[model samples]
Target: MKKYFNWANIRLVLIVLLLAFLYAFTTKRNENRKLCNTTVEFQDGEQLFITHEMVNKLLIENKRDVSSIRKVALDLNNLENTINQHEMVEKAEVFVSIDGHLKAVVKQKTPVARIFEGSGSYYVDYKGTRMPLSAIHTARVPLVSGGVDNKNKEDLYELFRMIHDDEFLKKNIIGIQVLPSGSLIMKNRNFNYDINFGKTINMEKKFKNYKAFFQKAVQDSSIYNYRIINLKFTQQVVCTK
Candidate 1:
């Protein structure tokens, strides 16, 4: 019985050593493997700002192509950092798969409005951060001009968010101009009237009043007779002909 127990112990030790050797060998082989392929995926909807080719170009290291590099030579964190630095990229993940493939997953910024300051224009993203205009695709958002600077950008962002969230404002409002006195004037589509939105305060009530007035004006065929629709007052929409 003692001899049989000794034989069982010897077999268990050999099996354990064999498994460890196999694991080490497999790991070493995987480390030495060359990159097989690369895949780039956009998380949200279709990519509008950055292209796949642009992202691939960013993966190039010291003029060396990523696909030509070995798995051992790849710096996954560095690659991720580089892609995240792109103006349109909100976040990115870079990793190497078990099959020796490199992958990059990216999420892009969504532009809520376009701001025209002087001769140049830029986009304000949903997060209220300023983003440079994309040569790839132009977003169909409300245009803003006049008296917009760094100090008042936050206020502008709030106004843009309100407009973006409302279907009527998103469809009909074409442009917004900020006055030197910190007031806002809006331009609508298919109408020659200006919206006198004096300040950004009491926004929900102002919008509600304007909508009610617009519906009534449209029903009575009096929409085109107005030159100005003032919503600066509380609980009222004052119009001028």
Candidate 2:
């Protein structure tokens, strides 16, 4: 028994107990500490949909006084849920740090296309979800008008993705109009004429032809010579004067 309780062994036991006590004390202090500050951040540098003041208001309204004494007493889950429920927020993560700072990171819904039907206007996200127009900031995405509704939001989103990925289309194309027969018409930013896109099918081939035709027309300085450029037929571009 005396050999087991040597000086080295005693020191090792004391160090282990000290570590446990310090850990428990730190945990207790952290749990009892008051909330020092609250900070909000966006995940993808998106500042269009929400403001800092708005996020603070949401926490205060939902958490009912974030100035609560105990850090662990705050309802962080409820706060996260409340912020996530906001129309502009795609997701939110709320947590209290060890330094007693309450932090929330929010991901805003990304607008891929803006749909303008009559007087009604809204945003369509990349996930095919319709979001309300933001009064905070305007997203310079492709505007789609005519024959648009919830049923065709997915199709519009797909088209918007294609336009966004294409460097030439993203810089030039401004608006897309859906016809009654489900055909499409695209308006350019620099041209007075319109592109008669016959159907949504064979989009890759149609866009390829359109790109080639646009290059040749621009090179010839005759792009504006035609009123309407149609890319409906296979491997052919029909121009109307």
Query: Which is the leading candidate under lDDT?
Result: 1
lDDT of each: 0.87, 0.84
Q: Which sections of candidate 1 miss by over 4 Å? A: 1-9, 62-66
lDDT of 1 by residue, 19-95 (tens): 99999999899888887767789996578999988887776564455557778888899999999999998899998
Compose the digit string of candidate 2's lDDT tens values, residues 127-237. 777789988799888888888766665666788888888899888889999988888999888988889988787888888898999999999989979899998896799
lDDT (C-alpha) at residue 87 in model 2: 86
Q: Candidate 1: TM-score?
A: 0.89
Scored against the true structure, residue 228 in model 1 reaches a CA lDDT of 98
